[model samples]
Target: MVNIANYNDLVVGDRVIEAGNSENFQTGDWRSLIPVIDIDKCIDCFTCWIYCPDDCIIIKDDMIVGIKATHCKGCGICAKACPKKAITMTPEE
Candidate 1:
């Protein structure tokens, strides 16, 4: 009989995450969502920028807000921070 533990991908050194390599993650699992902003209703109060834990919301000149998805963890803070309901949390396609 073959050992069950023998057939796994384990790569040590330089490639490990600082959060550490987790041994139990399946494919297609979601860790976050991306926040989308509606420019029409946004007043650019900078609430989202201040509230974002990842500092991903970039507001420019009180006119537009940009969501940096690469740096964003999508904790929905921007949605909550928006006083005008201008932000929504949507999953990446």
Candidate 2:
């Protein structure tokens, strides 16, 4: 059987004790909402990418492509930063 740590066994704070180990943790599973990008409405201004805390915005050749759902925590910062309203937060189903 797999061993899982309960709340009492977890660390006290949200600190990264080791450097260059953030990739080992995947935080997307707990998000209640997800960001959706409308490529048609995107102006390629990179506004969403600038404000995204998780770096979930995907850019290609100077164009906003999509969101990286695997690492996105649905903070809604990207949606609010989109000047063209190209990004929207939707409930995760």
Best by TM-score: 2
Q: Cα deviation in Å at residue 81, candidate 1?
A: 1.8
Clashes of 2: 0
Clash pairs for candidate 2:
none
- Per-model root-mean-square deviation over C-alphas: 6.8, 4.3
Least accurate 10 contiguous residues by lDDT in model 1: 21-30
- Clashes found in each candidate (C-alpha, N, C closer than 3 A): 0, 0
Considering summed lDDT, which 10 consecutive residues are worst modelled in model 2? 9-18
Tens digits of per-residue lDDT for model 1 on 2-89? Answer: 6554324644643555563342333223336778899888887788888887666776666565876556666787798789999988
Model 1: lDDT equals 0.70
Best by lDDT: 2
Task: Report the C-alpha lDDT of model 2 over 12-93, residue by residue, as the tens digit.
Answer: 7955566877666788886999989888998899988889888888888888888888788888999898889888889977
Model 2 lDDT on a 0 to 1 scale: 0.84
lDDT of candidate 1 at residue 85, scale 0 to 100: 95
**lDDT scores for all predictions?**
0.70, 0.84
